[model samples]
Target chain A: MPRPQPEPVQVVKQRRDAALKAMVEGVPYVQWLGISFDRRGDELTAILSYDEKLIGNPLLPAIHGGVTAAFLEVTAIVELGWSMIWDEVEAKKLEPEDLTAGALRLPKTIDFTVDYLRSGLPRDAYARARVNRLGRRYASVHVEAWQDNRSRLFAQATGHFLMPQRDG
Target chain B: MEDRKATLARQFIEAIPHARALGMDLTELGEGLAEIVMPYADHLVGDPSTGVIHGGAVSTLMDTCCGAAVMSHPSIPAATATIDLRIDYMRAATPGQSLRARAECYHRTRSVAFVRAVAHDDDAERPVATATGAFTIETNGGAT
Candidate 1:
C-alpha cells in the first residue's frame, strides 16, 4: 500500500480552527460569561469581555474573583482539550467535523488553585494556559490572566484534570 | 453585633454585580461565617448532555462565600479581596438543584484571613465541592 500523503498547510489550519471552535462552543458557561477565544494555530487566548455584570466590587470597581477563576479555568480546559484534539487529528484518529457542542468530552477538574496578584480592573481580561503535564489518565495546566499588559498578570492558576477515556 | 455583621454581609452580596446576576442569596451570616445560595439556571449548565452545573459556577459560589466570611469576621469587619483560593471538586452538582456554599473564616492575622468552605446541593450530606482560601484583610474600612 502507498503511504498516506501529508496534509497541506492550509488544510491543517482549517482543521485546527474547526477543532478549537467546537471545543469552545461545547460549554454553556463560557457563553454565560461572554468568554471568547482567539486562535492562532494550536495556541489559544481566552478573552473575557468587560461587562457591568462582571463587577464584584462596585466600590473598587473590580472584576469578581469568581469570574476571574472561571475565565482561567475555561482557558486551561479549552487549551488542554485543543492539544488533545490536535494530536488526535494529526494521528488520523479524529476529524474536526465530527466535533460538536457536547460531542467532544473535556477533562474533568480534580482541583484548581488560583492566586490573585491584583484586583482585576473593570475591563477586558485575557488568559492563556500552558500544559505542564499530560498523561494517559490526568493532565496539569497552568493559566495566567492579564488585563492590559501581558507581563502584569492579575491572576494565575494551576489545575489538575482527569482525562476522558478514549475508545479503541 | 451579629445583626450588624449580617446586614453588612447581605449588603456585601448585593453590591456585587456578578453575585446578583447569578441570583445568590445570603441565607445565613454571623461573625466569620457566611452561607449563600445560588439557584440553578439553564445558563449555568456545563455539560449539556448530562445537564450538570459547571464547575466554574461552583467555584464562583465558593469564592464569593469565602469572601463574605472574611468580611464578616470579628477581627476584620472591613472589605477584603481574595489573595488565593484552592478548590476541589467532589462530584457534579445535580441539575435543577440550587447550590449552597457555607464558609468560615477560621483564622486571621493583621493582614490576612484564612477561610474554608463547602458547597452542597439538595443533598447536604455529600458536598459537591470544597474550598480553602486566603484573603487580604483591610481592617480600616479600606475598600468597602
Candidate 2:
C-alpha cells in the first residue's frame, strides 16, 4: 500500500481550526452539557447553560460534582487549543506529518484534580482557564467555574495534558 | 433497617440529574460501599477519532458511586457535598463496554467522610480510572 502523504500546511491549519470549532459548537458531550465558548483577544471563556439535568442534589438543587469537574476540564482543553497557537513560520519548520504540525492540536488528559469550594446552584455557570505553561510535549492549566459572580467560585480545577510534539 | 437504608441510598442516586441522564444503575449498597454501572452509549464519546467513552463519563460514574457510598454509611447525615476529588486516569476505556464503579467510604468524622473508588469495564484487575474524594456531612440535627 502506498504510504499516506502529509497534508499541506494550509490544509493542516484548516483541519485544526475546524476541529476546535466543532469542539466548541457541536461536540456530543459538550452539547449535551450545554457548553458554549466565547473568545476575546487572549481570553477564552466556557459557558454552561443552566438545566435541570445538571442538578445533583435535588434538595439543595445544586449541580453535580462530576458535571462541574467536566466543565472545568473542558474549559481547560478549549483554552489550550485556542490560545497555544504556533506562528506560520514555526509551522513551516516542523515535521510535515507531526501531530502538532499546525497552530493547534488535540490534547489528552494526564491528570485532573478538582476542588469544590461551594455548591453549584441551578443557574448558568462560566469557566475560564489559564495556561500555566505550554511545552512541546505537555501543558498545565488552571480553571475556575463560577455562577452569578466571579468572586463566588463554584469549583476550581488543575489539569495536566499530554500534547503532541512538533519540531522547532 | 438495611433495606430501608439501601432504598434511600438508591433514591438519592436517582435524584441527581447527571446520574439520571447517564442511566446509572445501583447494583449494590452496604454500610459504606457502593457499586454502580453506566451502560455504553455512542453520544458519550469524547474524541471523534476514537469512539471510546469520555473521561468525564468515567469521572461521573466514580463520583456518583462515591456519593452513594457516603449516603449509605452507618453515620449517614441529612445531606452531603463533595469537598474535593482527585482522579487519575490509567488509560482510555474501551469503546463498547459498560463501565462499573465501586466505591468505599473508608472513614467518617463529625463533619467529613473519606471515600475511594475505581472504575473498570470487564477486567477487574485493570482499572480505567481511580479516585479519592472527601465529602462534607450536614451533621447533628441536620441528619435526614
Best by TM-score: 1
Q: Residue pairs in steric clash, candidate 1?
A: none
Q: How many clashes does the backbone of model 2 have?
A: 2
Model 2 chain A poorest 10 in a row by lDDT = A94-103
Model 2, range B1-144, lDDT digits (tens) per residue? 868856865686677877989988888888899999999887777775667776777778888899888887887676778899888888888888999999999999888999999999987888999999999887667544
Across residues A70-126, which tens digit of lDDT does each residue of candidate 2 receive? 889889888876655435323543333433322334677888989999988889999
lDDT of 1 by residue, A29-137 (tens): 8898999999876778999999999999999899999999999999999989887777777666676446878888889999999999999999999999999999989
lDDT of candidates 1 onward, in order = 0.89, 0.80
Best by lDDT: 1
Give the interface RMSD values of the models in order: 0.7, 3.2
Which runs of model 1 end up more than 4 angstroms from their true locations?
A: A1-10, B1-9, B141-144
How good is the docking of model 2, as DockQ?
Answer: 0.47
Task: Determine which window of 10 residues in candidate 1 chain B has minimal summed lDDT.
Answer: B135-144
